[model samples]
Structure formats: C-alpha cells, structure tokens
Target: MTNLTCFKAYDIRGKLGTELNEEIAYKIGRAYGQIYCPQKVVIGCDIRLTSEDLKQATIRGLNDAGVNVLDLGMTGTEEVYFGAFHLDVQGGIEVTASHNPMDYNGMKLVRENARPIGADSGLKDIQALAESGHFQEMSQKGTTEQYNILPEFVDHLMTYIDPAKLRPLKLVMNAGNGAAGHVIDALEDKFKQLSIPIEFIKIHHEPNGHFPNGIPNPILIENRGYTSDAVLAHQADMGIAWDGDFDRCFLFDEKGQFIEGYYIVGLLAQAFLLKQKGEKIVHDPRLVWNTLDILKEYDGIAVQSQSGHSFIKDMMREHNAVYGGEMSAHHYFRDFAYCDSGMIPWLLATVVLSETKQSLSSLVEDMIKKFPCSGEINFKVKDTQKTIQKIFDHFADQKPMLDQTDGVSLDFGAWRLNVRASNTEPLLRLNIESRADQNPKPMQDYVDELTQLIQS
Candidate 1:
C-alpha cells in the first residue's frame, strides 16, 4: 500500500502526481464508500486538467463499491456542498485544489446535509482506509449519470437579494479562468431575465485549467492589479475576483482599492443584521475589532470560531449563526448549508451598494480607517510553536489580554495581534489590528517588533 499525503485538516489538496492522483482518488472513493455506505453520492470537478480524470476514477471506485454517482460537471466547491444537501444524494465530493498551483489538484468531501468531513471528522479514517488499500465486499455495481446544477445553484443565490431590488450597476468580474465563469454567465442571464440591469465587465471569463492570467487569487498584492485596473478603467461599481475553485472571493472598490476580507465581514454582518436583528454572527479570532463593533452596533450576537471551514461550519450550526466570516475571504451562510459561497458575498455587497447609494469604498471606508490591519503576514520559521511562545513571552510584560480560540491572540489596550501556525504549512501567520480610535502606529510598530522577534 502506498502512503497518502494529500489529506489535510479540512480537505485533500497536494501536488498532482506525487501526493494526489487518479489511483489515490480511486482509493479515496472506495474508502469513502465503504465508510459511509451511502446509497447515492454527488460528484463534481473543477477546471483543472487532472480533476476530470480523478473524478472519473473516483466514480469508478464508488460504482464498484455499490454507490451510485451524480456527476455535476465542472463546478465550484460550494456547488458540491449545495448538491449534497439539496439533491437526494447522501454524500458529495468536489475534485478541486482551490487556489493551489497549476501542478496540484484535490478534493473536498461532505456527508449528508452538506456537513463537512474534516480531519477530525472521518477524514483521518478515510485516509487510514485508503492507505490500507482494502475494502468490504460490495452487494452490486452502482451507476453514474450526468446532472446539471447550475440553474438550481443560481436560483438559490438569488434568495439573498430580491431581483427587483437590485439596481443597475456597472461592475467588473474576474473569474481567473476557473470554475466561476459558468456561474457568472448564469447569474448574468438571470439578472437580465429579471430586468435587473447589471453590466458585468468580464475578465479571464473563460474556464481554462492553464490559468493564463496567472493564478486567480486576489489576496496576493501582485494578483490584485488586473481587477483594480479594470474597475478603474470601466468605472464600475466594484471589482470582484475569485480563486481557482471560486469558493472564496476578493473585492475592490470603485476607486480601484482592494477591500480587505476583514471589512467585508463587517459589511456583510451589517447587511445581515439590518435584515434580521439580534441574530448571531460567527468570526475567526484573527480579526475581531471591526466585526464585533458592527455586530454590537446592530445589537447582534457575536460568536468566535477557529479559522478553518470545518471549525466555522460547526460553530455556525451550533450557534445558529446567520453568517460566519474569516479574514481570508471565506464567507458562510446558514441558508447555504453553513458552507462558504463566493457568489453570495458579492450579491450581498451589490444589494448593500444599491440600497445605501454608497460607493463600495464609501461603504467600507470608516470601518477600514477605524480598524487598520496588517492583513496576514506569514513568516517561514524553523520552529513555529517555539517562536509563538517567544513572542508571547516578550509581550507578556504589559499584561495583555489573551484568547486561544484559534491561535495565541494577545490583546494590548490599543492594538492586538494573532500568532497562529499554518495548519497546512510550516509557517506562522501573524495578523495585527488596532482599534478605530487609536493611531495606526501601534499596529505597525507591533508588526515590526513581532517580525524581529520571529526572526530572532
């Protein structure tokens, strides 16, 4: 039996040939079928060149293990999540590497009701079973059939905002040549059919696995230029871009300014709170000041969860939270099976823009100015845990408040810093944010101090 290294905290993602491939995918399918023993399963794939082959191999394994499959060809991760809960299928899997490099591909799995199956939640068991390369006897061969879920997915997305309420606005959409193009086209048609005028300036609109316009990640400073430039050139209402799988989206204002995911969390929190007050909002520990302030002003409850999909989804369900967000562009909704949707966030933003009659920048300007953040800085350290302890020790003198919801978060009076090790890599991720009324110097000063501390 070959060792499988693709499994991670939340999903299966790794290099194409060495860590993840067709044989491993087949083993995973067999293992999942044996473990869950579901009558039927939904399967989807992204535009990666290897994802289709992997999807087929997994389907074969599932069929051999007496599990039927519904193939939703080339979709985002959220689509699989939607199909799992919405369709009659008892399980779902999406073959995608998300924002990973061109040389990689992977899968995200969910059980009934689209509940995530993370490392602690049956992923390790699946890995063990796959590594063993053994399975139980099958009763009979299952079957496979094609299924188109685009219309249903788009219909569900429309529930967040009334079509009649959506105003005519010129916008720029950058799909990054991933799975988002299809959904964009579908939504465009829906908008036009409803007479809700929305002019979308499409860039890298076609689905191509090669990623000709570099990787479709707007988080990186370098990859943000295209969206910002197009937004300014077209004088659109806002600019939106997504990762390879289109699970997470990044936004920019009309002035060609990239809005941090942190502010979007607060913006969406307000959007939800306005619709239904006193509802709970879940957020990660990485950035809290802005989101908590918004929730407080709206008289909404705020819940803190760890910074991963599995953690956020579980917390959202537990708290019955209407919305959940992380600083890293993932936005979740209770109506969407507690799964994050790249489509929902933008739609919500557009509705807010139209209703408030505010520019995208103006909508989030005060929040950004009040709670300036360092975004998220990653340090490739030799000892992540030891480095975190060292930094915590250095800052302990002032007697800062501490929270270990996700990572070691130390809160001084004016500014706060979260030092957490990356779940997938050997790097320590640092995020610093200051209170709105305070000077920005404290945030930057702490960043420099922490940078030197990590280096030392």
Candidate 2:
C-alpha cells in the first residue's frame, strides 16, 4: 500500500510532485467515487498552476467510476461548497492549497448539503481506499459538463443585505492575485446594477497562479501591508484581503490597522442580533468575552464550540445558529448551508457600518477597550501536551475555572487564558484576554508572563 501523506486531519494538502500529483489526485477521485458511488459531483480548482491538471485527472477518475462531473472551472474553496449544498449534486470537491506554501497543493471535499468530510468524517476511509489501490469496475463511463455557479452564487450573497442600506463608501480590496478576483468582479458588477454607492479600489486583483504578491495570506502580519497601504492611500472605508482559495477573509480598519478576527466576531454577532433577537450565535472557545458581551446586550443566545470548521458547523446545526465565527477569520452562516464564507462577512460588515453610522474602527473600538486580547500567539515546542500541562500546573494554585472544550481554557475573575495545540501544526496556540475594568494592566504583561512560562 502506498501511504498518502497528503491526507491531513481535515483536508488533503501536500508538497507537490512527491506527496501530491496527477496520479495521486486521480486515485483519490477514484477512491471517493468507489466508496460513495454518487451519481453526480461538482468540482472546481483555484489559481494554482497545477490545480487544473490535477482537477482534470480527478475528473477522469470520477468519469471512469461512472460518476457524472460538473466542472466549475477556477473558483475559491467556498464556491464548490456553495455548489454542493445549493445545487442538486451529491458531492463537491475544490482543488486548492489555500494559503499553504507555494510548492504545496491540496483539496477540500464535501458531501451532499456541503457537509465537510474530515478525518473523523470520511477522509480516513477515502485515504485508505486510495492507498490500497483497489477499484470497483463500472459497466459504463460517466459524462462531464461545464457549469457556471457564479450568477446564482452572487444572487444568494445579495440576500444577506439590502442594497438600499449600503451607503456611499470607498473600499479597498486586495485579492492578492488569487481566485478571489473573479468573484469580486461579479459583485462589483452587481453593485453597479443595483446603484449601490460602494466603490472598490482593487489591488492585486487579477488571478495569477504565480502569486505575484506572495501567497495572499493576510493573516500573517507581513502580508497585511499591501491591503493596509492601499486602504491608507485611498482613505477607504475598509480593507479586505483573502487567502489563496478565498475561504477566509481578513479585514483592516480605515486607519489601515488590521482588526483581529475576534472583534469581528462581536461586530458580526451584533449585526445579526440587530436584525433578530434571541437568535443563536456560535463562536469558538479561543476568545469569548467580546462575543458573549455582545450577545448579552442584544438578547442573543451564545453557543461555544471547539475551534475548526467541522466542529463549528456541527454546533451551528445543533443550535440552529444564525451565524458562527472563529478568531481565525472563518465565518459561517445558517443560510449558507452552515459553511464558512470570506465574501459574506464583508457584506454584513458594510451593512453594520451603514446602520450604525460608525467607522470600522469605531464599531470595534469599544469592544477592544472593554476586553483586551493578546491575539493568538504560537509557540513551537517538542511536546505539546507536556507544555500545556505545565501551564495548567502553574495556574492550579489560583484555582481558576477550567474548561477543556477545544484546548485548556482557564478563566479567572478578571482575566482568562486559552492554550490549545494546533490541529495542522506542532505549535501550541495561546490566547489571553482580560476585562479592562477588572484588570487595567497592559495586555503585554500577560503575554510576557505566558511567554516565560511557555518557554520555560
């Protein structure tokens, strides 16, 4: 059996040539076809150069397995997700590395209704089937067709907000030369037709597999300057930058300051709550005070879920949450088949700005002051569990309330700390926050103290 290193905890991602290539992708497609035996599936690829070749190979395998395929051409990860749930197809696959290194490539898979196929879901079985090189011969071959899901997708996105409510605003959009450009163009045209006074100052707007301006991951501080600089230069209302597959979007304020995703959770929760009270809002456990605080004021129910898309989507379904958000910038919507979208958040944000008549920074400024967070800090350690336990032992004397929902969360009266091992990496991710009223000290002090404990 050929072990496949490309299959990760949630999706398929690997270095090019060795771990992933046309042959391996074809086997994966065949494996999925054999296991699920679906009659039809929708597929798409990102801006990566190798993505198209691998996508075609996968299509060939699926066709050989007697599964009809609908190709959406080049698209973001969420587009395939949209196709899976919105269309009549039984499954969807997006060939994308999604902000990984330049030499890497991957795929994200979903079942009917856009339910993710993760490690605990069906990824392991798919991996095993692919590794075994087993095949179930079909009597006949299936056909392939080209489909355009864009118009329907843009129409659905417009449902999230009233175009009339959108006021005159100049916005900066940096696609980072990834797959987001096409969607942005579609939305731009829609805005023009609707006569919405939103102006888009686009940079790195073209789709380029070469990634002229790096990998399009704005989460890293270094990658943020392009969007920030443009926002400042244009004095735009807001700045938006997306990753390679455009599944997650990061936002910047009018001041060109990168806003933490934690605060945006509160902002979006407020936006939803303003529309309807007593609705459920799901959020990850990493940062909670801001979201909980907003939910409390808006009379909305708050549900905490472990981090990651699979867990968030499950919790959203269970509670029928109107919306869900993670500090990592992945936002989910109940109407969108509980799948995360990089497009919807900015739209909702624009709505919030219009209704509140507040600048992006002003909207989140109070929340930031009330509950200061240390953002997410990463520490590379030899033993993740050992380090987590050590931190637990240090804080045991204080007898803080601890919750192990995703990782270790210790809540003190005035402050709290959450440390969790990353699902995709060996690093221990830490987040610390304090109520400004209860503890007025600098957030850096908490960072310093944790840094000492973690390093020691």
Candidate 3:
C-alpha cells in the first residue's frame, strides 16, 4: 500500500504534484464515499488554479461510489460548513489550502451538522482505504448538481446581530484577492437592501488565483500594512483582513494598530454575555486572564479547551457554549453549528462598536493594559519535548501552578507563560503575559527572558 502524507491530524494538506494531485483527490473522495456511504454530500472549492480540476476528479469518485454531490462553486471554508448542516446533505468537503503556499492544496471535511472529521474522527479510516485502493461496487451511480449557498449563508450570518443597532460607520476590508470577495459583495448588497448606513472601502477585493497581492494571510507582519494603511487613509472605524479560505480574520483598530486576537476573544465574550446572561464561552489555554476577568464580571461561565478547531468545537458542543474564541483568531459560535467563521467575528465587533458608542481600540484598550501579552512567538527547534523539560526544570524551584491542556502552561501568580510545539510545523510556539498591577517588570522583560531560555 502506498502511504499518503497529505492526511494531517486535523485535515488533509500537502504540497501539490508529489504529495497531492487529481488522482489522490479522487481516491480520497472514493474512500470517503466507501466508508461513510452517505447518499448525498456537499462540496466547494477556493480560487486556486488547480482546485477546479481536483474538484471535478473528486466529484467523479463520489459519483462512482454512488454518492450524489452538491457543488457550491468558489466558496470559503465556512460556506461549505454552512451547506453541510443547513442543506439536507450528510457531509461536506472544502477544497482549500488556506494560507499555504501556491504549490500546496488541502481539504477540510465535516460530517452531518458540520461536525469536523479530524484524524481521531474518521480521517485515518479514509486514509487507509485510499492507500490500499479498496473498492466496493454498486449498480447505480450518484449524480452531481450545482448549487448557490451564498444567499442562505449570508442570511444566516445576519442573525448574529441586529441591523437596527448598526450606526453609520466606515470599514476598510482587504480580501487579499482570495475567495472572501464574493461573500463581501453579497453582504454589501444585503446591507443596501436593508438600508444599513455602513460604508465598505474594499481593496484587492477580486478573486484571482494568482494571488497578486500575497497569499491572503494577515497574520504575517509583512501582509498587514496594506489593510492598516487603508484604514488610516480612509479614516475608517475598523479594518479587517482574512487568509485564503477566510476561516480566520485579523482586525485593526481605528488608529491602524493591529489588535491581538487574544483581546478580541475577551471583546467577543463580553458582547455575547451582554445580550444574554449566564451563557457559556470557551477559550484556549494559551491566554486566559482577560477572558476569565470579563466572564466573571458578566456572570458568564468560562470553559477552557485545547488549541485546535476540532477540539474547541467538541468542547463547545459538550458545554453548549454560546461562543468560543482562540487567541489564534479562530472564533466558533453555537448558532453556526459550532463551526469557526471569519465573517462572524468582525460583524459582531461592529455591533459592539455601535452599541457601546466606542472605538474598537477603546473597547479593548483596558483589557490589553490589564493583561499584557507577548502575542505568539515561534522558534524552530531540534527537540520539542527536551526543550519543554528544560524549561520546566528551570522553573521547578518556584513551584508554579501548571496546566498541560494543549501545552505546558506555568502560572507564577503575577505572570504566566505557555510554551507548546506547533501542531502543523516543526516549531515551538510561546506566549507570555503579565498582570500590569501585579508585576513590576515590563512585559518585554519576560518576553526577552523566555526568548533567551528557548534559544539557549
């Protein structure tokens, strides 16, 4: 049997030609159909040049395996997630590599109601079947049909906030020439029909496979200047940018400063809690103080989960959480079948802005000051476990409280840090934070100490 390296812990991702190609895509589709044997499945693709051909091959495999296909042409990841749960299909697949390089492509799969299918949940089975080239013959073949899910998807997004509460505000949006442009256009049309007074200044808003601007990842420091610059030049209220598949969005305040996703978690938690008291909110372990403080004041329950989307989604389903936010900018909502959405976060942030009559920075400035964080720092390491043990030994004398949920989190009362190996890369990720009132040392001091320790 041929080993397939494209199957990852969470989803399928690999470099094209060698790791993944049309033939392999077909095998994946056939394997999924053989294992699940679902009568109907929903599928969509991003604007990548190779995506359409791969999608067609996948469709052929699904049809050959007797599973009908509903194709949503050119959609972001969440759109496929929406179709999986909202439509009468039993599963969905999104042909997207997100922020990966042009030579790479991937797929995100979900079962009924948009529940993720990670390695622990049926991904391994599909991989085995595909690797072995197993087949089951059927007399009847399934059919393929084209469908438009944008209108329904946009309508569902509107349910997250009240249009009446929105004020006249200007927004700067940079789509990075990916799949997000079409969704933005549909939302803009809806706003005009409803007479909302929000103005959108769009840039790089067309879907071009070449990615003329970049790969659409706003998380990179180099890719953020365009969005921030446009926000400042237009005097906009807020600026938003998204990655290729548009699953996670990064935000910039009115002053053109990039707000860390950690603070946005607290902001979103407060927004939901204000509307309904006693709601549950899930957050990752990487950063916690700001979220906990806000939840305590709002009389909301806070639950902590590991750092991945599948783990966070499972925890949200278990706790019936109203909202879940990761410091990595992935936000999940109970209303959206516990799936993460790039579009939802910014929409809710706008509502918060209008309701409080405050700027984006003002709403989050206190949280940033109260709990200063070093964001996330990454380093390529030779041995992750050995490095973690070294750090633990160094801090053993202080007897800091430790939490090993997703990584090693050491709480030293006044300041805390979490260091973990990256899930998708061979790198160690670190995040440190300090309570401004409780610690006399600056946040940068702790950052430098950790950097030196990790490097040495």
User: How many clashes does each candidate structure show, in the order listed?
Assistant: 1, 0, 0
For residues 3-27, write the lDDT of model 2, one tens digit per residue.
9999987889889999999999999
lDDT of 1 by residue, 1-456 (tens): 777889988889888889988889999999999999999999999998999999999998899889999999999999999999999989999999888778888999999999999998999999999999888878798999999998999999989888778788998999999999999999999988888888989999999988898878788889999999999899998999999889899999999999999999999999999989999999999999999999999989999999999989999999999999999999999999999999999999999998998898889989988889999898899989899899889988999999998779998868899999987655799999998686647667877888888998
User: Which whole-number lDDT from 0 to 100 does residue 271 have in model 2?
Assistant: 84
Clash list (residue pairs), candidate 2:
none
Candidate 1's TM-score reads 0.97
Q: Please give each candidate's TM-score.
A: 0.97, 0.96, 0.97
Candidate 1's C-alpha runs over 4 A off are 440-442
Better of 1 and 3 by lDDT: 3
